[model samples]
Target: MMKSLITTLLLITGISMAQPNHLPTSIPQTMSFQAMITDTLGNPITDGMHNFRFRIERPNPVQGGQVHVIWEETKQVAVVDGVISTVLGSVTPIGAMPFSNNFSLSVALGNEVISVSPLTSVPFAFNASRAMSANNATHADTAHFTHQAGHAHHADS
Candidate 1:
């Protein structure tokens, strides 16, 4: 009998707040993914290397709503005492993913899929990034509007 493995997924993002006047030119698009592999008996399986497939999916239905796969990639990861740690987007850039949308993660080991789990709120950092960019643009637009209004008032005088 093939023992089924259980995996626990953890998602992490790095977010930093800059000063009002100092905005970062760019934000990192990578996220950290860690997993622990264990057997039914709750014992960690110390596997050397395994091909782990990860999928980020959102609900999309034809009539109502169905699950759709937005992004997927298989990577060879080293498991030490059943703990696997790797940075997502390192293999394939996930910058284009719709992080603002609700998504879930699916994990597969070899030909057998292990588990499908809901993603945490950590992905909101991507939306936060967009907000930061919008803040900068808003400031620029306000400045332009002020300058333009000043010129118009001067012309009226």
Candidate 2:
């Protein structure tokens, strides 16, 4: 029987403050994926290492507009108490995959295709990268500065 699926993909950007002078030049190319492996009867699978295949896809404009697979890889993940927590792109870098566009993910546990989820939101860090590219100005225009005079009056006055 097919296993029940509860899957999540969260893109996390870790800013290192320990080395404030050495900030990262680029956002990380990985995301955290978690799923609960359960049987059809809602029982957790036995805790152990399991093999899973993952694919990142987008809608293809060519070939009559089918889903296009951009990346795929197999990974061995450790499942504890029916929960599998793993970081995607650990084996291979998902470098510059253009998460700015619509994308979806598909997964297969062992030999069974388990779930497909839509990637509806892009991480805030990704948007920061877009802002950097959108700017063309080297200096601030219409800049202004002002100074105000200050006076103190006596309490009695």
RMSD of each: 16.3, 16.5
TM-score of each model, paired residue for residue:
0.60, 0.65
* Stretches of model 1 off by over 4 angstroms after superposition: 1-24, 63-66, 123-157
Candidate 1's displacement at residue 73, Å, is: 1.2
lDDT digits (tens) for residues 1-157 of candidate 1: 2232222111111122222444445566667888898877989876799998988888886747768887788899999999999887788767666656888888887867778888876577668666544423323333433342322222222
- Quantify all predictions' global Cα lDDT against the true fold: 0.69, 0.72
- Among these predictions, the greatest lDDT belongs to 2
Count clashing residue pairs per candidate. 3, 0
Question: In candidate 2, where is summed lDDT lowest over 10 consecutive residues?
Answer: 140-149
